[model samples]
Target: MVSSDESLPQRLPPIDRALDRYPYCIVWTPIPVLTWIFPFIGHMGICMSNGVIRDFAGPYLVTEDNMAFGRPTRYLRLNPKNVDGGSSAWDEGVSKASVLYGTRMHNIFCDNCHSHVATALCNMHYENRTSWNMIILCFWMFVCGKYVNVCGFVKSWLPFLIFISIVVLMAVYF
Candidate 1:
Protein backbone atom coordinates (compact mmCIF):
# COMPACT_ATOMS: atom_id res chain seq x y z
CA MET A 1 0.00 0.00 0.00
CA VAL A 2 1.31 3.44 -0.94
CA SER A 3 1.51 6.03 1.83
CA SER A 4 1.24 9.79 1.42
CA ASP A 5 4.44 10.23 3.42
CA GLU A 6 6.33 8.09 0.91
CA SER A 7 5.89 10.65 -1.85
CA LEU A 8 7.57 13.59 -0.12
CA PRO A 9 10.98 13.18 -1.72
CA GLN A 10 9.50 13.46 -5.20
CA ARG A 11 8.13 16.89 -4.35
CA LEU A 12 11.42 18.48 -3.33
CA PRO A 13 13.07 20.89 -5.75
CA PRO A 14 16.41 20.02 -7.29
CA ILE A 15 19.50 21.62 -5.83
CA ASP A 16 21.10 24.22 -8.10
CA ARG A 17 24.68 25.08 -7.26
CA ALA A 18 25.05 27.61 -10.06
CA LEU A 19 22.18 29.58 -8.58
CA ASP A 20 23.28 28.86 -4.97
CA ARG A 21 19.88 27.47 -4.14
CA TYR A 22 19.47 24.58 -1.68
CA PRO A 23 15.95 24.28 -0.42
CA TYR A 24 15.41 22.85 3.07
CA CYS A 25 19.10 22.30 3.65
CA ILE A 26 21.69 23.04 6.26
CA VAL A 27 24.76 24.24 4.41
CA TRP A 28 28.39 24.06 5.52
CA THR A 29 31.72 25.58 4.42
CA PRO A 30 35.29 25.38 5.58
CA ILE A 31 36.70 28.13 7.78
CA PRO A 32 40.21 28.49 6.34
CA VAL A 33 42.85 27.74 9.02
CA LEU A 34 40.31 26.45 11.54
CA THR A 35 38.74 23.92 9.20
CA TRP A 36 42.12 23.02 7.68
CA ILE A 37 43.10 21.56 11.03
CA PHE A 38 39.72 20.16 12.09
CA PRO A 39 37.69 19.28 9.06
CA PHE A 40 34.55 18.71 11.11
CA ILE A 41 34.45 22.32 12.16
CA GLY A 42 33.11 24.92 9.72
CA HIS A 43 30.55 27.62 9.13
CA MET A 44 26.89 26.65 8.81
CA GLY A 45 23.61 28.14 7.68
CA ILE A 46 19.94 27.38 7.07
CA CYS A 47 17.98 27.95 3.91
CA MET A 48 14.51 29.25 3.17
CA SER A 49 11.87 27.42 1.15
CA ASN A 50 13.19 29.17 -1.94
CA GLY A 51 16.73 27.93 -1.15
CA VAL A 52 18.23 31.32 -0.25
CA ILE A 53 20.84 30.80 2.46
CA ARG A 54 20.73 32.70 5.75
CA ASP A 55 23.64 32.75 8.17
CA PHE A 56 24.74 34.63 11.21
CA ALA A 57 27.82 36.15 9.61
CA GLY A 58 29.08 38.06 12.64
CA PRO A 59 28.04 40.23 15.55
CA TYR A 60 24.69 41.73 14.75
CA LEU A 61 24.77 40.45 11.20
CA VAL A 62 22.78 37.82 9.38
CA THR A 63 23.64 37.42 5.73
CA GLU A 64 21.42 36.21 2.90
CA ASP A 65 22.90 34.06 0.11
CA ASN A 66 26.32 35.12 1.42
CA MET A 67 27.76 32.43 3.64
CA ALA A 68 30.37 33.78 6.06
CA PHE A 69 33.20 31.44 5.10
CA GLY A 70 32.33 30.79 1.46
CA ARG A 71 29.90 28.81 -0.64
CA PRO A 72 28.77 25.62 1.06
CA THR A 73 30.98 22.59 0.43
CA ARG A 74 28.51 20.23 2.07
CA TYR A 75 24.81 20.18 2.88
CA LEU A 76 22.36 18.18 4.97
CA ARG A 77 18.97 18.36 3.42
CA LEU A 78 16.09 18.15 5.90
CA ASN A 79 12.53 16.92 5.50
CA PRO A 80 10.00 19.71 5.80
CA LYS A 81 7.23 17.30 6.70
CA ASN A 82 8.81 17.09 10.11
CA VAL A 83 7.77 20.65 10.63
CA ASP A 84 4.28 21.28 11.91
CA GLY A 85 3.36 23.71 9.15
CA GLY A 86 5.68 22.13 6.66
CA SER A 87 7.40 24.53 4.19
CA SER A 88 5.93 27.69 5.68
CA ALA A 89 6.92 26.66 9.19
CA TRP A 90 10.42 25.81 8.05
CA ASP A 91 10.84 29.21 6.46
CA GLU A 92 9.46 30.93 9.50
CA GLY A 93 11.87 29.10 11.76
CA VAL A 94 14.89 30.13 9.68
CA SER A 95 13.69 33.69 9.52
CA LYS A 96 13.01 33.90 13.25
CA ALA A 97 16.40 32.55 14.18
CA SER A 98 18.22 34.84 11.75
CA VAL A 99 16.50 37.85 13.19
CA LEU A 100 17.25 36.81 16.77
CA TYR A 101 20.92 36.30 16.06
CA GLY A 102 21.23 39.59 14.27
CA THR A 103 21.19 41.42 17.60
CA ARG A 104 23.70 39.23 19.39
CA MET A 105 27.48 39.13 19.56
CA HIS A 106 29.35 36.35 17.81
CA ASN A 107 31.21 33.90 20.03
CA ILE A 108 33.31 31.09 18.71
CA PHE A 109 32.62 28.68 21.54
CA CYS A 110 29.16 29.63 22.67
CA ASP A 111 27.00 31.66 20.31
CA ASN A 112 28.01 31.52 16.68
CA CYS A 113 27.03 30.20 13.30
CA HIS A 114 26.09 26.76 14.51
CA SER A 115 23.90 28.25 17.18
CA HIS A 116 22.05 30.18 14.54
CA VAL A 117 21.28 27.04 12.61
CA ALA A 118 20.26 25.22 15.75
CA THR A 119 17.92 27.97 16.77
CA ALA A 120 16.08 27.58 13.49
CA LEU A 121 15.69 23.86 13.93
CA CYS A 122 14.54 24.33 17.48
CA ASN A 123 12.04 26.93 16.44
CA MET A 124 10.58 24.49 14.00
CA HIS A 125 10.74 21.74 16.61
CA TYR A 126 12.50 19.53 14.13
CA GLU A 127 12.33 15.83 14.84
CA ASN A 128 10.24 16.79 17.86
CA ARG A 129 13.31 18.07 19.62
CA THR A 130 14.44 21.51 20.76
CA SER A 131 17.82 20.53 22.15
CA TRP A 132 19.88 21.16 19.02
CA ASN A 133 23.32 22.49 19.75
CA MET A 134 26.80 22.77 18.28
CA ILE A 135 27.91 19.29 19.24
CA ILE A 136 24.81 17.58 17.87
CA LEU A 137 24.70 19.65 14.72
CA CYS A 138 28.42 19.19 14.13
CA PHE A 139 28.24 15.48 14.66
CA TRP A 140 25.21 15.08 12.39
CA MET A 141 26.67 17.19 9.62
CA PHE A 142 29.98 15.36 9.74
CA VAL A 143 28.26 12.00 9.62
CA CYS A 144 25.34 12.63 7.29
CA GLY A 145 26.17 15.67 5.21
CA LYS A 146 26.81 15.15 1.52
CA TYR A 147 29.40 16.96 -0.57
CA VAL A 148 28.03 19.38 -3.09
CA ASN A 149 30.25 17.69 -5.68
CA VAL A 150 33.74 16.30 -6.24
CA CYS A 151 35.20 19.75 -5.73
CA GLY A 152 33.34 20.00 -2.47
CA PHE A 153 34.83 16.78 -1.17
CA VAL A 154 38.32 18.05 -1.93
CA LYS A 155 37.68 21.51 -0.57
CA SER A 156 36.40 20.03 2.68
CA TRP A 157 39.10 17.47 3.41
CA LEU A 158 42.18 18.18 1.27
CA PRO A 159 43.61 20.84 3.51
CA PHE A 160 43.15 18.73 6.61
CA LEU A 161 44.73 15.74 4.91
CA ILE A 162 47.71 17.84 3.80
CA PHE A 163 48.10 19.33 7.24
CA ILE A 164 48.10 15.87 8.84
CA SER A 165 50.67 14.57 6.34
CA ILE A 166 52.99 17.52 6.95
CA VAL A 167 52.72 17.03 10.69
CA VAL A 168 53.45 13.31 10.37
CA LEU A 169 56.46 14.05 8.16
CA MET A 170 57.76 16.60 10.63
CA ALA A 171 57.42 14.14 13.48
CA VAL A 172 59.34 11.49 11.54
CA TYR A 173 62.17 13.91 10.72
CA PHE A 174 62.39 15.27 14.23
Candidate 2:
Protein backbone atom coordinates (compact mmCIF):
# COMPACT_ATOMS: atom_id res chain seq x y z
CA MET A 1 0.00 0.00 0.00
CA VAL A 2 1.25 3.60 -0.82
CA SER A 3 1.79 5.96 2.12
CA SER A 4 -0.66 8.88 2.50
CA ASP A 5 2.17 11.47 2.70
CA GLU A 6 3.58 10.28 -0.65
CA SER A 7 0.26 10.92 -2.38
CA LEU A 8 0.39 14.68 -1.65
CA PRO A 9 1.87 17.04 -4.23
CA GLN A 10 4.89 19.18 -3.36
CA ARG A 11 4.23 22.82 -2.58
CA LEU A 12 6.27 25.46 -4.34
CA PRO A 13 7.99 28.31 -2.49
CA PRO A 14 6.72 31.88 -2.82
CA ILE A 15 7.90 33.77 -5.91
CA ASP A 16 9.30 36.60 -3.74
CA ARG A 17 11.65 34.13 -2.10
CA ALA A 18 14.25 35.06 -4.68
CA LEU A 19 14.15 38.63 -3.45
CA ASP A 20 15.35 37.59 -0.02
CA ARG A 21 18.94 37.98 -1.14
CA TYR A 22 18.31 41.68 -1.65
CA PRO A 23 17.15 43.12 1.66
CA TYR A 24 17.14 46.60 0.20
CA CYS A 25 16.41 47.63 -3.39
CA ILE A 26 15.43 50.58 -5.50
CA VAL A 27 12.09 50.06 -7.22
CA TRP A 28 11.18 51.82 -10.45
CA THR A 29 7.84 52.38 -12.15
CA PRO A 30 6.58 54.33 -15.14
CA ILE A 31 4.79 57.62 -14.63
CA PRO A 32 1.08 56.97 -14.72
CA VAL A 33 -1.05 58.85 -17.32
CA LEU A 34 1.99 60.93 -18.33
CA THR A 35 4.21 58.35 -20.01
CA TRP A 36 4.04 60.14 -23.37
CA ILE A 37 5.25 63.48 -22.00
CA PHE A 38 7.89 61.87 -19.76
CA PRO A 39 8.65 58.39 -20.94
CA PHE A 40 11.95 58.22 -19.08
CA ILE A 41 10.71 60.09 -16.00
CA GLY A 42 9.42 57.36 -13.75
CA HIS A 43 8.83 56.99 -10.03
CA MET A 44 11.35 55.48 -7.64
CA GLY A 45 11.07 53.99 -4.17
CA ILE A 46 13.08 52.01 -1.64
CA CYS A 47 11.97 48.43 -1.18
CA MET A 48 12.32 46.80 2.19
CA SER A 49 11.87 43.17 3.10
CA ASN A 50 8.43 41.56 2.57
CA GLY A 51 7.52 43.86 -0.33
CA VAL A 52 7.30 47.08 1.68
CA ILE A 53 8.29 50.21 -0.25
CA ARG A 54 9.12 53.63 1.16
CA ASP A 55 8.59 56.59 -1.14
CA PHE A 56 8.00 60.28 -1.02
CA ALA A 57 4.59 60.26 -2.63
CA GLY A 58 3.96 64.00 -2.29
CA PRO A 59 4.81 67.10 -0.30
CA TYR A 60 5.29 66.47 3.41
CA LEU A 61 4.41 62.81 3.00
CA VAL A 62 6.56 59.73 2.95
CA THR A 63 4.58 56.53 2.68
CA GLU A 64 5.25 52.85 3.03
CA ASP A 65 3.17 50.72 0.74
CA ASN A 66 3.14 47.18 -0.56
CA MET A 67 4.17 46.72 -4.19
CA ALA A 68 3.95 50.53 -4.26
CA PHE A 69 4.34 51.00 -7.99
CA GLY A 70 2.43 47.90 -9.09
CA ARG A 71 5.48 45.69 -9.43
CA PRO A 72 8.78 47.48 -9.99
CA THR A 73 10.26 47.31 -13.48
CA ARG A 74 13.72 47.12 -11.93
CA TYR A 75 15.46 46.54 -8.59
CA LEU A 76 18.75 48.34 -7.81
CA ARG A 77 20.51 47.02 -4.76
CA LEU A 78 22.11 49.64 -2.46
CA ASN A 79 25.03 47.39 -1.42
CA PRO A 80 24.48 47.34 2.31
CA LYS A 81 27.70 45.43 2.92
CA ASN A 82 29.70 48.42 1.72
CA VAL A 83 28.49 50.52 4.66
CA ASP A 84 31.26 51.47 7.09
CA GLY A 85 29.45 49.60 9.85
CA GLY A 86 27.90 46.15 9.86
CA SER A 87 24.59 45.25 8.22
CA SER A 88 22.43 45.80 11.30
CA ALA A 89 24.04 49.15 11.99
CA TRP A 90 23.62 50.17 8.40
CA ASP A 91 19.96 49.23 8.51
CA GLU A 92 19.46 51.37 11.57
CA GLY A 93 21.22 54.30 9.97
CA VAL A 94 19.05 54.03 6.87
CA SER A 95 15.93 53.88 9.02
CA LYS A 96 16.97 56.97 10.92
CA ALA A 97 17.72 58.78 7.70
CA SER A 98 14.33 57.89 6.26
CA VAL A 99 12.60 59.26 9.33
CA LEU A 100 14.56 62.49 9.10
CA TYR A 101 13.39 63.15 5.56
CA GLY A 102 9.95 61.65 5.91
CA THR A 103 8.24 65.02 6.05
CA ARG A 104 10.47 66.94 3.67
CA MET A 105 8.98 69.03 0.87
CA HIS A 106 9.09 67.26 -2.49
CA ASN A 107 10.54 69.30 -5.33
CA ILE A 108 11.37 68.34 -8.90
CA PHE A 109 14.71 70.12 -9.06
CA CYS A 110 15.73 69.63 -5.47
CA ASP A 111 14.30 67.19 -2.92
CA ASN A 112 12.22 64.67 -4.81
CA CYS A 113 11.41 60.98 -4.43
CA HIS A 114 14.77 59.97 -5.88
CA SER A 115 16.43 62.17 -3.31
CA HIS A 116 14.53 60.35 -0.61
CA VAL A 117 15.96 56.99 -1.62
CA ALA A 118 19.41 58.40 -2.33
CA THR A 119 19.61 60.12 1.02
CA ALA A 120 18.69 56.93 2.81
CA LEU A 121 21.33 54.96 0.96
CA CYS A 122 23.91 57.66 1.44
CA ASN A 123 23.29 57.68 5.17
CA MET A 124 25.32 54.51 5.38
CA HIS A 125 28.36 56.41 4.11
CA TYR A 126 29.16 53.68 1.59
CA GLU A 127 31.28 56.06 -0.54
CA ASN A 128 29.14 55.40 -3.63
CA ARG A 129 26.88 58.31 -4.52
CA THR A 130 26.23 57.35 -8.12
CA SER A 131 22.53 56.94 -7.43
CA TRP A 132 22.24 60.55 -6.30
CA ASN A 133 23.99 61.78 -9.44
CA MET A 134 21.77 59.57 -11.57
CA ILE A 135 18.67 61.08 -9.99
CA ILE A 136 19.90 64.60 -10.66
CA LEU A 137 20.66 63.76 -14.30
CA CYS A 138 17.26 62.17 -14.78
CA PHE A 139 15.56 65.24 -13.29
CA TRP A 140 17.56 67.52 -15.56
CA MET A 141 16.69 65.46 -18.62
CA PHE A 142 13.00 65.55 -17.71
CA VAL A 143 13.07 69.29 -17.20
CA CYS A 144 14.82 69.73 -20.56
CA GLY A 145 12.01 67.65 -22.09
CA LYS A 146 13.59 65.06 -24.38
CA TYR A 147 11.33 63.57 -27.02
CA VAL A 148 11.01 62.64 -30.70
CA ASN A 149 7.95 64.44 -31.97
CA VAL A 150 6.84 67.65 -33.71
CA CYS A 151 5.27 69.29 -30.65
CA GLY A 152 8.34 68.61 -28.53
CA PHE A 153 10.91 69.40 -31.19
CA VAL A 154 11.76 72.78 -29.68
CA LYS A 155 12.04 71.66 -26.11
CA SER A 156 13.51 68.23 -26.80
CA TRP A 157 15.81 69.13 -29.67
CA LEU A 158 16.41 72.81 -29.02
CA PRO A 159 20.00 73.06 -30.33
CA PHE A 160 19.33 71.04 -33.47
CA LEU A 161 16.07 72.84 -34.16
CA ILE A 162 17.73 76.23 -33.69
CA PHE A 163 20.54 75.33 -36.08
CA ILE A 164 18.09 74.09 -38.71
CA SER A 165 15.93 77.18 -38.31
CA ILE A 166 18.97 79.41 -38.76
CA VAL A 167 19.99 77.52 -41.93
CA VAL A 168 16.51 77.85 -43.36
CA LEU A 169 16.44 81.59 -42.63
CA MET A 170 19.87 82.08 -44.29
CA ALA A 171 18.77 80.11 -47.38
CA VAL A 172 15.53 82.11 -47.68
CA TYR A 173 17.25 85.52 -47.26
CA PHE A 174 20.55 84.96 -49.13
Candidate 3:
Protein backbone atom coordinates (compact mmCIF):
# COMPACT_ATOMS: atom_id res chain seq x y z
CA MET A 1 0.00 0.00 0.00
CA VAL A 2 1.24 3.51 -0.75
CA SER A 3 2.04 5.41 2.44
CA SER A 4 0.43 8.82 3.04
CA ASP A 5 3.66 10.53 4.20
CA GLU A 6 5.53 9.61 1.01
CA SER A 7 2.99 11.46 -1.16
CA LEU A 8 2.75 14.67 0.94
CA PRO A 9 5.54 16.76 -0.58
CA GLN A 10 4.58 15.78 -4.14
CA ARG A 11 1.07 17.15 -3.57
CA LEU A 12 2.25 20.56 -2.32
CA PRO A 13 0.61 23.23 -4.47
CA PRO A 14 3.28 25.48 -6.00
CA ILE A 15 1.93 29.01 -5.54
CA ASP A 16 5.13 30.89 -6.26
CA ARG A 17 5.76 29.28 -9.64
CA ALA A 18 3.06 31.28 -11.38
CA LEU A 19 3.91 34.50 -9.52
CA ASP A 20 7.55 34.40 -10.61
CA ARG A 21 6.93 33.14 -14.16
CA TYR A 22 4.05 35.46 -15.06
CA PRO A 23 3.72 38.58 -12.91
CA TYR A 24 0.65 39.73 -14.84
CA CYS A 25 -1.30 36.66 -13.75
CA ILE A 26 -1.66 38.26 -10.31
CA VAL A 27 -5.44 38.60 -10.81
CA TRP A 28 -5.68 34.82 -10.57
CA THR A 29 -3.79 34.76 -7.25
CA PRO A 30 -5.91 33.42 -4.41
CA ILE A 31 -3.45 34.61 -1.75
CA PRO A 32 -4.21 38.36 -1.81
CA VAL A 33 -7.95 37.76 -1.72
CA LEU A 34 -7.58 35.43 1.25
CA THR A 35 -5.44 37.91 3.15
CA TRP A 36 -7.90 40.74 2.60
CA ILE A 37 -10.81 38.60 3.67
CA PHE A 38 -9.08 37.29 6.79
CA PRO A 39 -8.54 39.80 9.58
CA PHE A 40 -6.62 37.41 11.82
CA ILE A 41 -3.87 37.08 9.22
CA GLY A 42 -2.97 40.75 9.77
CA HIS A 43 -2.53 39.99 13.47
CA MET A 44 0.93 38.61 12.70
CA GLY A 45 2.14 42.10 11.82
CA ILE A 46 0.48 43.32 15.04
CA CYS A 47 2.13 40.50 16.96
CA MET A 48 5.66 41.21 15.76
CA SER A 49 5.26 44.85 16.74
CA ASN A 50 5.26 44.02 20.44
CA GLY A 51 8.73 42.63 21.00
CA VAL A 52 8.14 42.07 24.71
CA ILE A 53 5.35 39.53 24.06
CA ARG A 54 7.21 38.09 21.09
CA ASP A 55 10.23 37.50 23.27
CA PHE A 56 8.12 35.14 25.34
CA ALA A 57 7.80 32.97 22.23
CA GLY A 58 11.59 32.74 21.97
CA PRO A 59 13.77 34.18 19.23
CA TYR A 60 11.90 34.93 16.03
CA LEU A 61 12.52 32.53 13.16
CA VAL A 62 15.08 34.92 11.63
CA THR A 63 17.24 35.03 14.74
CA GLU A 64 17.03 31.25 15.10
CA ASP A 65 18.10 30.81 11.46
CA ASN A 66 21.11 33.10 11.90
CA MET A 67 22.20 31.28 15.07
CA ALA A 68 21.67 27.95 13.34
CA PHE A 69 24.17 28.91 10.66
CA GLY A 70 26.82 29.54 13.31
CA ARG A 71 26.24 26.12 14.87
CA PRO A 72 25.52 24.06 11.78
CA THR A 73 26.88 20.88 13.36
CA ARG A 74 24.51 21.07 16.34
CA TYR A 75 21.34 21.12 14.29
CA LEU A 76 18.77 18.40 15.08
CA ARG A 77 16.11 16.82 12.88
CA LEU A 78 12.44 16.28 13.67
CA ASN A 79 11.40 12.70 14.32
CA PRO A 80 7.99 11.13 13.82
CA LYS A 81 8.59 9.13 17.00
CA ASN A 82 8.61 12.36 19.05
CA VAL A 83 4.81 12.37 18.93
CA ASP A 84 4.71 10.25 22.15
CA GLY A 85 5.06 11.24 25.84
CA GLY A 86 8.83 11.88 25.85
CA SER A 87 10.41 15.21 25.06
CA SER A 88 11.87 15.73 21.60
CA ALA A 89 15.66 15.95 21.01
CA TRP A 90 15.42 19.57 19.86
CA ASP A 91 13.74 20.86 23.05
CA GLU A 92 16.96 21.88 24.81
CA GLY A 93 18.00 24.59 22.34
CA VAL A 94 14.45 25.87 22.03
CA SER A 95 14.11 26.09 25.83
CA LYS A 96 17.36 27.99 26.12
CA ALA A 97 16.38 30.37 23.36
CA SER A 98 13.09 31.06 25.12
CA VAL A 99 14.71 31.96 28.43
CA LEU A 100 17.32 34.07 26.70
CA TYR A 101 14.70 35.90 24.67
CA GLY A 102 12.60 36.82 27.73
CA THR A 103 15.56 37.70 29.94
CA ARG A 104 17.13 39.79 27.21
CA MET A 105 13.94 41.83 26.88
CA HIS A 106 12.99 42.15 30.56
CA ASN A 107 16.45 43.07 31.84
CA ILE A 108 16.34 46.04 29.51
CA PHE A 109 12.69 47.06 29.93
CA CYS A 110 10.79 46.26 33.15
CA ASP A 111 9.75 49.64 34.53
CA ASN A 112 8.47 52.64 32.57
CA CYS A 113 11.41 52.34 30.26
CA HIS A 114 10.09 53.94 27.10
CA SER A 115 13.52 53.85 25.52
CA HIS A 116 13.77 50.10 25.89
CA VAL A 117 10.39 49.56 24.22
CA ALA A 118 11.42 51.81 21.33
CA THR A 119 14.88 50.43 20.74
CA ALA A 120 16.45 47.11 21.65
CA LEU A 121 20.13 47.93 22.24
CA CYS A 122 20.53 49.71 18.89
CA ASN A 123 17.86 48.02 16.78
CA MET A 124 14.48 49.76 16.77
CA HIS A 125 11.60 47.72 18.18
CA TYR A 126 8.80 47.41 15.65
CA GLU A 127 5.83 49.42 16.97
CA ASN A 128 3.41 48.68 14.16
CA ARG A 129 0.54 50.63 15.68
CA THR A 130 -0.67 52.75 12.79
CA SER A 131 -3.86 51.16 11.46
CA TRP A 132 -3.30 52.30 7.89
CA ASN A 133 0.25 51.01 7.78
CA MET A 134 -0.72 47.74 9.41
CA ILE A 135 -3.46 47.04 6.86
CA ILE A 136 -1.27 48.07 3.94
CA LEU A 137 1.75 46.07 5.10
CA CYS A 138 -0.41 43.06 5.80
CA PHE A 139 -1.89 43.15 2.27
CA TRP A 140 1.44 43.33 0.44
CA MET A 141 3.08 40.85 2.76
CA PHE A 142 0.22 38.51 1.92
CA VAL A 143 0.64 39.18 -1.81
CA CYS A 144 4.43 38.88 -1.90
CA GLY A 145 4.56 35.83 0.37
CA LYS A 146 6.70 37.87 2.80
CA TYR A 147 6.32 40.66 5.36
CA VAL A 148 6.25 44.22 4.07
CA ASN A 149 4.04 47.34 4.27
CA VAL A 150 2.49 48.58 1.01
CA CYS A 151 -0.91 50.09 1.81
CA GLY A 152 0.19 53.71 1.48
CA PHE A 153 0.29 53.44 -2.30
CA VAL A 154 -3.26 52.09 -2.40
CA LYS A 155 -6.00 54.69 -1.96
CA SER A 156 -8.44 53.56 -4.58
CA TRP A 157 -12.01 52.30 -4.16
CA LEU A 158 -10.99 48.64 -4.06
CA PRO A 159 -11.28 48.44 -0.27
CA PHE A 160 -14.68 50.14 -0.41
CA LEU A 161 -15.76 47.69 -3.05
CA ILE A 162 -14.75 44.74 -0.88
CA PHE A 163 -16.46 46.13 2.21
CA ILE A 164 -19.63 46.91 0.27
CA SER A 165 -19.68 43.43 -1.23
CA ILE A 166 -19.32 41.84 2.22
CA VAL A 167 -22.10 43.97 3.68
CA VAL A 168 -24.39 43.27 0.78
CA LEU A 169 -23.75 39.56 0.98
CA MET A 170 -24.52 39.61 4.73
CA ALA A 171 -27.69 41.61 4.17
CA VAL A 172 -28.93 39.25 1.48
CA TYR A 173 -28.12 36.14 3.49
CA PHE A 174 -29.50 37.43 6.80
RMSD of 2: 11.6
Question: RMSD in angstroms, candidate 1?
Answer: 2.2
TM-score of 3: 0.19
The CA lDDT at 49 in model 3 is 12
Identify the runs in model 1 with alpha carbons over 4 angstroms from their true place: 1-10
Model 3 weakest 10-residue run by lDDT: 45-54
C-alpha local distance difference test of each model: 0.94, 0.56, 0.27
* TM-score of each model, in listed order: 0.94, 0.56, 0.19
Residue-pair clash count for candidate 1: 0
Question: Candidate 3 — which residues are off by over 4 angstroms?
Answer: 1-88, 106-174
Give the CA lDDT, 0 to 100, for residue 53 in model 2.
67
lDDT of 1 at 165: 99
What are the RMSDs of all candidates, in order? Answer: 2.2, 11.6, 17.8
| lDDT winner | 1
TM-score of 2: 0.56
Clashes of each: 0, 0, 2
Task: Predict model 1's lDDT versus the native.
Answer: 0.94
How many clashes in candidate 2? 0
